[model samples]
Target: MATDSQLATWEVFIQSKPGANYIHAGSVHASDKQMALQNARDTYTRRGEGTSIWAVPTSEIAASNPDDNDMFFDPANDKMYRMPTFYVMPEGAKAI
Candidate 1:
């Protein structure tokens, strides 16, 4: 009998252009950072889709709990001034 073990999981982020935001592309499995980067690039940018790539260990990323969405995100709703409705646009100004 043979046993198979998977490599450590890494989270992949890709930027389509310079100065663009790096979005979550997908995940890859590799034993080290360099390998993780190569795997991420090969798997995600096969068609030259990305200009830059970032690979981070899955264990190193901290994410907010989805179950506590109201507790974490609802406070912004109380600040009405943050909304753009209070501002009056000048005549002939294009809508942003």
Candidate 2:
């Protein structure tokens, strides 16, 4: 029921805990940024459930094209240390 100018889609992410990544809670449809924020609050934070919110326009999120990912990250393999699979934990060390 929204006109083209009035319809906006925002991807909502919520921080559920400290030192945690913002989780993709869901999306919201609203007339503008303010409304989207309020809607996100009602929908995702009704119970004080999150520590933060991020509402990025769905259209503004640029992702690596799947076909291009190979060319993009393949060079990173030259730095194997960037991956930690080989770092064994000291026998008694606990994960931070």
Candidate 3:
């Protein structure tokens, strides 16, 4: 039931250090999550390119709805104090 291109894609992320941010490494195509993980490891970490790795199937992710854009971003602009424009920079300080 699965075509070659229909084999799921898993996004590969790598964390170089314990506290560093995880970065998108690449993607893998496999029949299932388990296989995807193996493929991701073989394809992405062959040379110790990463200290840590994660493989997430692209379909399993649920993202914000584009239709809710207004409500999603409205509150952030309501509070103006969060901006640094109100205060003057200290003496000898470079322009922010």
Candidate 4:
């Protein structure tokens, strides 16, 4: 019997244009940073859609827990400055 030993997992981000923020494209498995970059490019930018690529180790990314939403994000609801009612839009302005 044979089993596959997967390489390190990398999260791929692609920038569609110069100066644009990188958006998550997909993931790739590679042995190292250089290999990860190559894998990301070939897998995600085949049509030359991306101007830049970022390949970050999946283990290195930090994410917030959804279960702690009230503790983390609800405080903004109590802050008066966050209310749009505090500002008046000009008469000719359209609703955003």
TM-score of each: 0.77, 0.64, 0.59, 0.74
Tens digit per residue, CA lDDT, model 4, 1-96: 655379879999999998778999999999999999999999999998899999999999998999999999999988898777777787886733
Worst 10 residues of 3 by lDDT: 1-10
Ranking by TM-score: 1, 4, 2, 3
Which scores higher on lDDT, 1 or 3? 1
**Whole-structure CA lDDT of model 3:** 0.82
Cα lDDT, all candidates = 0.92, 0.86, 0.82, 0.91
Off by over 4 Å in 4: 1-4, 77-80, 83-96
lDDT tens per residue, model 2, 1-96: 746675788999999978678999999988778888888989999998898888888899987898997899888979977877797778986753
State the number of backbone clashes in model 2. 0
TM-score of candidate 3 relative to the true fold: 0.59
Once fitted onto the true fold, the runs of candidate 1 whose alpha carbons sit more than 4 angstroms away are: 1-4, 85-96
Q: Pick the candidate with the highest TM-score.
A: 1
Model 1: worst 10 consecutive residues (lDDT sum)? 1-10
Per-residue C-alpha lDDT of model 1 across residues 13-95, encoded as one tens digit per residue: 99999977899999999999999999998899999889999999999999999999999989998998889887788889773
